[model samples]
Target: MSGRFQAAAPKAPSTLEKITKSPLFTVGLNTAYFVAGIAFIQSPLMEMLVPQL
Candidate 1:
């Protein structure tokens, strides 16, 4: 525990963090999720596994 070089604590969010939390980020995230959901539901593997799908 002596002479250990510890990293400093995290600072406040930067401009990049502010941009990431913007509405554009929310829309992008939601769109990505929607596309992934569609892909999962329409995948041939899912159809084969469910059989009744």
Candidate 2:
């Protein structure tokens, strides 16, 4: 019971794997960061253009 309660380790790719897939890796990483920052980071230009409600 106690042993089974432990959490699983996080699985992720190695640095080489990310570098080998450079274009996709960087684009995906940047896109994810940008989207996550949208709500926190304000941009007057963008707000003016789109007119936030």
Candidate 3:
């Protein structure tokens, strides 16, 4: 009888997890990353910081 117990329900996602899963949040995060990458690639700081491979 003890082995017949049902499995527990999954825990709910946290607020941060919910926010990050939203479409708008995903787009905004991707846009920010893209812009930062472009800025870093265009700036001279990239040359100073990274060695040519």
Candidate 4:
């Protein structure tokens, strides 16, 4: 490929890469996920899905 027409190498993190490694992003994300998990366990869905729950 000619220099002018060649694709440029990736110089920065893509959207998914940025999100996966972000500290502030994960802090809230992890907290919310944990909270949601707790709520899910206490919800009727848990009993219906896992009869032993």
TM-score list, all predictions: 0.59, 0.35, 0.64, 0.51
Q: Count the backbone clashes (under 3 Å) in each candidate.
A: 0, 0, 0, 0
Please identify model 1 stretches exceeding 4 Å from their true place. 1-12, 51-53
lDDT of 4 by residue, 1-53 (tens): 45577678979989998988999888999899999999999999898897563
Better of 3 and 4 by TM-score: 3
What overall lDDT goes with each candidate model? 0.92, 0.78, 0.94, 0.89
Error of 2 at 16 (Å): 5.1
Pairs of residues clashing in candidate 2? none
Residue-level lDDT tens digits of model 2 in 8-44: 8987989898696889888888988998789545766
Superposed Cα deviation of residue 38, candidate 4 (Å): 0.4
Tens-place lDDT per residue, model 1, 1-53, is 79989999989999999989899999999999999999999999787888563
- Which scores greater on lDDT, model 1 or model 3? 3
Quote the lDDT for 22 in model 4: 90
lDDT of 2 at 30: 91
